[model samples]
Target: MPPPASSQSCAPAPAPAYRGRFAPSPTGDLHPGSLMAALGSWLLARGAGGEWLVRIEDLDPPREVPGAADRQLAALRAFGLHPDGPVVRQSERGDLYRRALDRLLADGHAFECHCSRADLAATGGIHRRCVATTRRPRPAVRLRVAPDARVAFEDLVRGPQVQDVGATVGDFVLLRADGYWAYQLAVVVDDAAQGITDVVRGADLLDSTGRQILLQRALGLPVTRHAHLPLVTGADGRKLSKSESARPVDPTDPLPALRRAWAALGQDPAALAGADRVTDLLPAARTAFRPQLIGRGDTAS
Candidate 1:
């Protein structure tokens, strides 16, 4: 991902003073990538004098490993990132999501589908799954992806991103066949509900931007700034992810890890040295933070 700024004539659109959140699925512990995201987002919000919040994206129970949320919070604290308010638990917001689904259904922006992955994989993931099913159970909810649906925006870092939501993502799931609320739906609901106006996140989620934009349009949520930083990858060249057994960031000893991560990302960790307190660090980051300090492709930073 290209860095957000150039060293010359910087005219950054003000980082919104609205609330922002770092929502991580409880499928795994926080890792280096997670820390980078937490650091960037936390610093951005706090620097803008806005609320920095955390949300536990734990709506899917089968995929969620127990205690991952606690480990994640501990890791953030170890990194000196303290959230502004109590964490939001997606699992506890089922009624909210269900009500949203009913609203969307009544509004005709979404439809129910009963297609299996094997069934859709045959049609290159675009064919309707419930077209043949006469059942009224409404197995899963999918945004009725318009054939020409394209979402475009200028990312704060990776500028000029344009993606076709219907083609790249197809009629994406808002709810799963297993009765679990999907990530895209839950995330959009939470971000709007929480008043998030800036999204400083990993490049792995770059594609999700198109779908999220669609959700924002359907739900009439405010447009948030998007900054997609390159994701950290393993030695194998694959992007680091929870499913890959990536080593979790140490929640107890965040300094060494943050130091190593800063150096790894090519950012000068010493810039943040001699801080008065943990809370002071974020202000220092946002004030002195130069988005152009690092390049694309992350081992860190």
Candidate 2:
């Protein structure tokens, strides 16, 4: 077996470099909505003269597509969104997450629970009751949340934000009974591992930011600044999802989708409409990119 990861390896990376990342799950192809997230994060990093990276969130094997990771990378390249460093995949970094979980358990910040979804739902959608119990075949690890753990942060685009994770989410899971690492734990660990200083993604995940911040504090990791851009919804007013049959961006002719994505972020596309390729369009977009330009509410463009 390989050597176990040390505490240093799991801790937040030292700062000074302005690092940002675009992490996407490989459950399906890169749709227009996904492209918007990719573009927003890319522009923010590149515009700040910082390094931009990509990490494939391929931890959930059951929902992952067979060849989606490669396809997603190819699409990003076709759209002229290249990373500054080598790509990282969550599936290959299990040891790091395991080490972090061990630390949390050893520090008495986390515990094992066997509560099922039905059980949590009956308890007002929280695992508070089962936090101290360790009964059952395959138990999940949950973090002990303090009732007054109210986290607040300034969002670059949306202004001030605050949420009481302990009151709302309550002793969230770190690892599932099925043995897959929960997103809250993996995301916090990876953001620190990648030295991410800014998190630019769609507003759909804004609610979960509080939980992430709480986890970061529990792990003594640095909390990254967040900028949640407007989400692109369908005709039904629902945010676009790959699982719901949202069409993926056309790899051969990504210009149209790119233009739409640019506009969806509240940037004017007329300035770059004459450009033929993503390479020709990014320079001007980077010059004008700012999260504040994106308006509030779901964008239908």
Candidate 3:
């Protein structure tokens, strides 16, 4: 995060009102890096005078931690980032994803795949030769990315972006072979249903925007504006993630962690010194929010 702007010229564009969301998977407690994402999305939405919603992306039950969703929400409240609408859980929205998948299958946009992770890893994750019909009753479903098909979209912070989905990610999975909806499909459907206008999250997910865009187009749904913030990294130079043993943010005393997240976005935390509580600091932070100060790949160390 950058220093608080001294003049109006350095402020972020209070644009075309937004409906942003902070969707997180409940695999563990709210870690520091995850707090940055939560704060970034919350600030962006509040700054634009728009709605900020919360969605618990618990699609993969195998990875979800029991009671983690409620704990995550509690952490956000400790830092004063509350949602404008009812919180949504992806596990309860299977029917919506199934309906969307049915449409894609009916239109010949989606196909079944029996390839496993190990199988795709060997082929560089392209899955180019998996076109053969499923040998088993249960098979994963994948969206057919046309050869050399260029998917382009403007990222608010990263600028104009382009990617050849077929060459990069190949036929991406929409439904896993294990009877769970893939992140790509569930997120697209939920975002559309929730009327999410902007998506502000960690830069680690920047690459995923392209695939999500492809899904948006295939579903005939409007694509939302995206602004991926710089990721927070551990001392080892890798992203701070749950799987990496990243420490969870302190829920009992969230102020310090909240301040660190504020600074991580390149914002000057000193301005918030007088804010005795987290909720009190948010209004001013929202006003001082400047996404442009966030440089690409400027990971929080």
Candidate 4:
């Protein structure tokens, strides 16, 4: 059964003057890598005199850790990154996703896909066309990507970006066969519903930007400004993610982690050197943050 709706409704609301968000999944405790994303997004929003909201991307139940969402929120508060509005959880927004799927199906932008991973493995995992010989009771739904489908956008940090979505990823899934809402669909819908004006996240999600842009155009949703910060990587040059058991940040002593994340974003170290509290550190960091100074590539945590 779907979870009950959160305190806030998923219905589209009047666009805010300027809005940004830091959405985190409840797969584990807040780690240094995730902290960088949160801090980066918060700094961008506050620096621009915009509202920064928090959204819990708790859509995958099987992978979620119990109590992780509350812990993540508590840690953000400890770091003095408070949301301007009530926090929202994606698990409670099923109705919104369903409505989006219905619209896509009705318009012929999306179709039922019976292809499995194995069925498309020979084509490098790109779902170009249906290859399933036998149809399954539950089929994934995918957005139809045209042969000439292309998306081009200017990223605040990375500059000019372009992707041929049809050739690169083919017709991507909107609803998985496992009966779970795909991240691409949920994020695009929620961003529009929340009236997000800018999307500031890690560079790791850069590839997803084009796909999301396509979704925005297909749904007639406003395309938000994007800035992808440098990712925090481990000694092995791999991204330090929750799935890899990255060490969790200590909310009890947030200054050190906060400082590290600030440096990871390529801001000057002296900007937050004297800060002994999160309250003082955040304002100083926000004032000194320059998106142009943020470098591309992996930042060792």
RMSD of each: 8.2, 2.6, 8.3, 2.3
The reply for model 2, stretches above 4 Å from the true place, is: 1-8, 131-134, 242-245
The local distance difference test score of each candidate is: 0.72, 0.85, 0.81, 0.88
Answer with 3 or 4, whichever has the higher lDDT. 4
Runs off by more than 4 Å, candidate 4: 1-12, 242-245
> After TM-score superposition, what is the CA distance of residue 235 in candidate 4 from its true location, in Å?
1.3
In each prediction, how many residue pairs overlap at the backbone (N, C-alpha, C within less than 3 A)? 0, 0, 6, 0
Task: Assess candidate 3 and give its TM-score to the true structure.
Answer: 0.90
Candidate 4, 49-135: lDDT as tens digits? 899999999989999999999999999999999998889888888888988888889999999999988899899989888999789
**Cand. 4 Cα-lDDT:** 0.88
* Model 4 quality (TM-score): 0.95
Structure candidate 1, residue pairs in collision: none
TM-scores for all candidates: the values are 0.86, 0.93, 0.90, 0.95
State the lDDT of candidate 1 residue by residue for 121-153, as single tens digits. 667767543554344365778988887888889
How high is the lDDT of residue 226 in model 1? 85
lDDT of 4 at 164: 90
Question: Could you say which candidate leads in lDDT?
Answer: 4
Q: Could you give candidate 2's per-residue lDDT for residues 1-301 as a string of tens digits?
A: 1233333377776654578889999988888889999999988888778989899998899999999999999999999999988888888788899999999999999998887776676668776767333467888999999877789999988899989887888889899999999998999998998789999988989988999998898899988899998888876667887235478899889888988998998887777867886788888788767666787777874
Query: Candidate 4, after superposition: displacement of residue 46 in Å?
Result: 0.7
Candidate 4, residue 78: how far the Cα is off, in Å: 0.6
State how far residue 143 of model 3 sits from its true place (Å): 0.6
